[model samples]
Target: MGFHSFESPYDWSRIDTYRRRAEQCPGGLVDLSVGSPVDPVPRSVKEALAAAADDGQARGYPKTAGDDSLRQAATDWFRRRRGVDLDALGADLVPTVGSKEAVALMASLLHLGPGDRVVQPKVSYPTYAIGTQLAGAQVTTVDDPANTDSWVDLPGVRAVWINSPGNPSGQVIDRAGLSKIVRAARSIGATVLSDECYAMLDWSGTTQVGQNVSIPASPCILEPGVCGGDASGVLCLYSMSKQSNMAGYRAALVAGDARLVKAMTAYRKQVGLIVPGPVQRAMRAALEDGEAVMAQREIYSRRLRALVQALTAYGYDAVMPQGGLYIWAQARSGDCWADMADLARMGILASPGEFYGDSHRLRFSSTISDDQLELALERLHTGA
Candidate 1:
């Protein structure tokens, strides 16, 4: 097998090993390398799941395309949160195992092959590129989707990915900026897949607290006017994992372009890729309750403020995150591992920027507890 090694570029096992080493330290570790929310699920959702589990009907084979209630809930969510009346999405709506798996499988279903190009962000979640490779498509990294010049000349580019509230960088593309990319891609007949998984966590209010500046959250490809009434060549992927602390539930959905989603649904039905019945019920509860989502946001917001201020005070150049759980920071001394090693010595673990894309940067997560965060502040002060 002349298999190309997409797995080699990312070493999750190596990353885990480093985290384990830090965990073994006497003081215990504040593991911020992974962005898994260490928060409790809303009681409403938990109860909903429990109720669904006991309904007896859930024992039957789950609806592979998603249940009617789940699809309707997704539609209602789009109208309330996204400012779009998307009735066409109901039949097209299919609950995913999770957004990551949805993205990975999307390329294969789209029929991308060896010569096709899958354009993605220069610094991205890595899954986008890996998915493209799985379908034998080439990965083209576009540093800025807002800039038309960055993608105007790429050849054979079948699909372009835009991630708002980016994973490692925490950058968000504004409406006008996103409009430009959608126009450019549409002109060349390329599909745009916008990953707005972290759109719910906007931290724009705390930028001026210190030397760092926070950017505001903005939706790019989903802008109704930019997408031209019909979402023919556009799609938006979102997950309840971050917003609702339902990462283990594997609940997520892709909305947009009825035709595209319908094709995806057809392929998915054959493959048995569906969110379990109980998880779908849980997602419905999670989506309908706005208060619970905001409460979770507050938890992350408070932690972000403390960590951003602490990193700046410690002489590390912490680039205040615009949105999302990560703060992209650079070493004042310009050595990435030196900074990581320094933090690790104090039992604070962070993901190196090299894992995302470029070297010489590091990412800190705001998903830790308040108590652990305070301890991290102390470690930062003492470690440096």
Candidate 2:
């Protein structure tokens, strides 16, 4: 009841009120709030989906576990990008319709109810807590999710949610920080779910500090240094929405801990929650399209850099994040809603910090179109 839900008037309603105010500005609204991708879907992914549909492969129901090719592509991605070698049999990997549902349904899938507790980051993707509540489980939050002692020691803690290149903050936890969490959670028999949806979008050149893991972006929970190569109760969720511009395709996967994945697969099948057959093929193409992913990263990097510069000049304390598709910045006004009001005056709409549990800063998404971003930047610079 303490947290906002739709029935209780979720933050979106409040944010929307601000949005409407922005829409009334004489210059017209240039939305910098929503993180939906405006980029084109990778050519390879589109080709694969079209091929599947044209070949009549989309006529039947999809396997909830995902086809072997889709699952294998996931494992291969883990090995190539995450530097983590999952099970050779690859039963540890399973496709998800999209990472959001997987995240929202995680606690329910585990059948966790009232006496159980789920720990999540104070400012993270909201679905983690939503899922816990849907399962009738208690929710706890920590400022630093990778600090195991902060939540792992809590009584009856059954799950800990970790988001590297975290939402709203874009902070990445290195291997040592994550390893401590993994070890502590495992010691107490709690499941650790790492949301790595933005894994491929790091702008921070931060290293794995004390480890030799050559991960492409953020250090993954399934990495050897973090999990000690044993995925007993770890689950890493990856989404292609941002990187491959495949949000509409709902392509993503859960990989790690064969038993956990196997159990989730069973439950998913019962509910008919399978990725469409065409989407499954598209996911395979997306995973294999490293060039497209890298290209998208370059595009976002430029936009984020430009936004940071423009915001700083416009009296905001701005900097490129460690990783993720957002610019986390604090405005001259100090108050988040006040900053939103200031942006609204310029016909710009950015997410108020309170929407993501942060009252000190607003989030500007890099998923905007370049011309609109340019207009937003011009407005900020001129204080028009």
Scored by lDDT, the top model is 2
Please estimate how well model 2 matches the true structure, expressed as its whole-model Cα lDDT.
0.83
lDDT of each: 0.78, 0.83
RMSD of each: 4.6, 3.0
Tens-place lDDT digits, model 1, residues 274-307: 7889898999999888888888887888788788
Q: Which ten residues in a row have the lowest lDDT in candidate 2?
A: 1-10
lDDT of 2 by residue, 103-144 (tens): 988888877888999998988777787888888888898999
Estimate the TM-score for candidate 1: 0.92
TM-score of each: 0.92, 0.94
